[model samples]
Target: MSDTAPADWDPRSPKVLDNQIQAYDEMRHRCPVAYSDYLLWSLFRHEDVMRALTDHETFSNGASRHLSIPNAMDPPEHTPYRRIVEKYFTQEHIDEFEPVCRANTEALFDDLPPEGDIEVMSALAQPFAVRNQCAFMGWPDSLREPLRQWIGKNHRATRAGDRQAMSKIALEFDGYISEQLILRREAGEEAPPDATTRLLHEKVEGRWLSDEEIVSIIRNWTVGELGTIAASVGILIHYLAAHPELQEALRQGHENLPEAIDEILRIHAPLISNRRITTRAVTIGGREIPAGERLSVIWASANRDEDVFGDPDEFQPQRNRDNNLLYGAGLHVCPGAPLARLELQVFMETLLAKVRHIELSPDTTPERAQFPASGFASLPVRVQRG
Candidate 1:
């Protein structure tokens, strides 16, 4: 029989879910490594998460039962697929995608009202994510609405920990991606030249990637770009709206946008956590666990670690950038970091270009997103256009 530690904290408690970041902040100070039935074992400190990240042998990424392509694979298998993914996110591709990303951002801005209060999620953040992903993948505009709805269903299922619902939601998204693959294959040379079509030609270990593999790749991209991007947009804007001096400084000098974006996200993570599992028995933050138990690497907590960042909320982009696990570290560092950076930089630039000021709406306070996700659920804000 395997040794199992008693529960250290309840992840499903109403308090934790109600305000995830604050709860994580408390947990990081109180019990760096905590256990709950839902998460099994959760590493809340920067040191613990980094150890799990850098040492892949002891801390494995093959935690998901579903096929996760490169992200879910280890070493020998993970290497080649990761190489393929890296190619798509190269600076060249990022440069090529900039104009399209900019045009999409501009079009979305046109829909925003010139001066009054706005529900940024529906008005801007959510739609921007859907459009950016669809445009980059060469998906049709018709898909924008369905994909938006899919993100809602996906988040609801994830938060509920409903495996059955999660499986169905995954399939529902797979079907959407599968149809695109089919269309590209049917069109042959006439198919739209986009990321989705390009993946059809990706080779792994001298063998063409299978349909299932391609879907998994796109699924990773959609989840990365849509949900996280939406959350990020809200977080970035919210941070700026709350800090007028910082917002004005950013507006005055557009060059500081990228570092500023990373720093803000470090304060409020767009992604709450990622999963890992122990290949063998190990101890983390003095908590013991047996082999094969799952672990939750809580990014939200790790990034804000007081030991690393001093004052977790203090904005120190240059000092904290090296330690920020925003994209992660080691073997599984996000391959799409370049693309994510470019998307965010352009988004901030476009907004700051036309909007003279951004302030939180006094009419309705922003609603915090629940566990499994971060950032505001509904952000009502006032933006003054120049």
Candidate 2:
């Protein structure tokens, strides 16, 4: 956006950041097409966000300076890379990984006290997110702790808006991915037949993908999947703890676990927003946005827009299923939806099987994560296995 453009609101302001969902709710109604210094052009309404998602020509995903695989590409460039990504998350692969994902969940739960208080973010959400991500990529057990710590540093840098720090952190993540690529190459035929190895030989437009491109793809997967999965876990458990009647209902017969998880996440989105750059001048929500400006699709706001979902907070899974943007829509939809859904369902099924009840602590509230992240930063809950 031009520096001279008038600022409509501050996305980083205390009023907005303190309670992001509520702030966004207000924004969607008051000013759907909002402009700010931090987020150049932010679309808060469901209709406008949907327009941007479907119209790739006007709102291009090639917004990032660095390479970002299919997530940052548009159309022809995005198609083949997306195909490679989809293969890894196919039903066959998800079915194959289910047992492994469950084992990781069970091991994590085993460390928790049988009938006592636990911080769900650290004890349950983050660890399982990190470990399961590693397992999916066939990364070794050693990467689990480092990746967990790295996510913290990355989040801190992002919230601080520290460009140099973010760049360094990006390089740090690239290093981890690049090293794995090296090991796979060195092992040749002996390399484990994991997603990383398969990516090594993936072709697009009759050419092998560069090492840089490979690293970019894995980086997107690791960061996106890990953060959102962790947030989803926290949100799911916190919701269950807060609504015991529904929780008990599902625990008794978990056939609704998949639907319940989707509805809960839609109400409190795990992934907050994604970015784009305008390919040409466009008018959205009665506001004219010039070409070459940054655009942010506020998924958190769009999914909760009262116009579409009736009451934003109503837990109507079956009713909201068709319109839920949990995994997004159109050409740029998340390729790993199958794997992510499988992981969450398996994790919750295992948790419900092992634990008798989940309840939020009477004295503590799960601290909300700040902007750029959704869900609890620290979630305290009482778990009873007896």
Candidate 3:
């Protein structure tokens, strides 16, 4: 299906597809506000990206151009749903999730076959990342495979722009959540101190949420987290293996693991681009963007803008500035960022503590996922005991 991208679609090149940050930087400098027949206008500058995000009213989130969320809805209506989810993704909840995530990471690492080929994506990153979400939501372990498959189908549907497929999978996941809600209701209790419970109990639009809204909220979490986290972790692990010095540095200062994780995330910026429908005609970066048309703000590109970051391509874990749009910006910035940070920190700390060495397999190359989500299908590598 469309493996060869249009010439103007910069990041779609085979080489750049694998290394999105590099490709995004190259395109930003050459065509900051580029146009493709398919994706309309793409904005790449950091300041421009910031402006678009902050001006939420003009770039309304409920444009029906994309799926549900505060990501797709403006303020007033957006704020309440965001607040409901924000409470669950708070610093306290993230801290609570740390131990379980760490344990899972370590267990997966321990189980990897040593001194031979192992596809880290399947054996470690993919499963561990999804299971981490299950742990966070307190979902039954029985639902893991089904949820993972749902995630895959949902991702595929989104890329294909198949609304019917999206609705189908949405209902499938929603049905599962509905059953869970039934079980929780039978117990006549709130959610078990996790996102699900918070969704079940919280009010969205001046009243408690319905089962559909709760399921949609969980869908947002799974879509926002699962694949992107897995991809970022896979890429981070590959980098760590290639750069043993960095891995050693991280191992020595486990305290700086969080900082290290942030920097790595900044470098990779898992999800490639976010789409926003322009409410009014706006001229940005010398390009005229029309109202009601969609524009993509490339987070990967903005993170590497020379204006925002010096030597932008280099990986410097201790960079003190917020130059990256990895977590996005302004009104629609990712609310689940704190939880994501916690997961990354715990995973890195546990992985470093458990493994003596990590090396890429000779015949292995990661296969990047389709658009919306930038990640790998398989990341094969080898692990040595600590």
- For lDDT, the strongest prediction is 1
Tell how far residue 357 is off in model 2, in angstroms: 1.1
Cα lDDT tens digits, model 1, 1-386, are: 13456778998899998889999999998989988878888999999999999999999999998999788999998999998888888888889999999999998887777899999999999998999889888899999999999998988998898999999999999999999999999999999988889999989989999999999988888987899999999999999999999998988894378999999999999999999989999877887778898889999999999999999999999999899999999999999889889999999999998788999999998998887778989999998887
Q: In order, what lDDT does every prediction score?
A: 0.91, 0.90, 0.75
Rank ordering of all candidates by lDDT, starting from the highest: 1, 2, 3
Please provide, for model 2 over 205-318, each residue's C-alpha lDDT reduced to its tens digit, 9 standing for 90 to 100: 899999999999998999888999999999999888889888888888944889999999999999989999998999899998889989899999999999999999999999
> Any residue pairs clashing in model 3, and if so which?
61-72, 61-73, 62-72, 62-73, 191-197
Worst ten-residue run, lDDT, model 1? 1-10
Q: Report the Cα lDDT for residue 279, model 1.
A: 94
Error of 2 at 290 (Å): 0.5
lDDT of 3 by residue, 1-386 (tens): 12242436644447765666666787788888887655667888888888778887667556553357656778787888787778887777777778888787777777876557788778877788788988888888888889878878887887666889887888898788888887777766544665666567777667888776677678777878887788788878877887788889888884377767777767767778787778888888887666776778887777777776777757776663465677877877888888888787777877887788888877877666656667567777777877
Poorest stretch of ten by lDDT in candidate 2 = 247-256
For each candidate, how many residue pairs have backbone atoms clashing (under 3 Å)?
Answer: 0, 0, 5
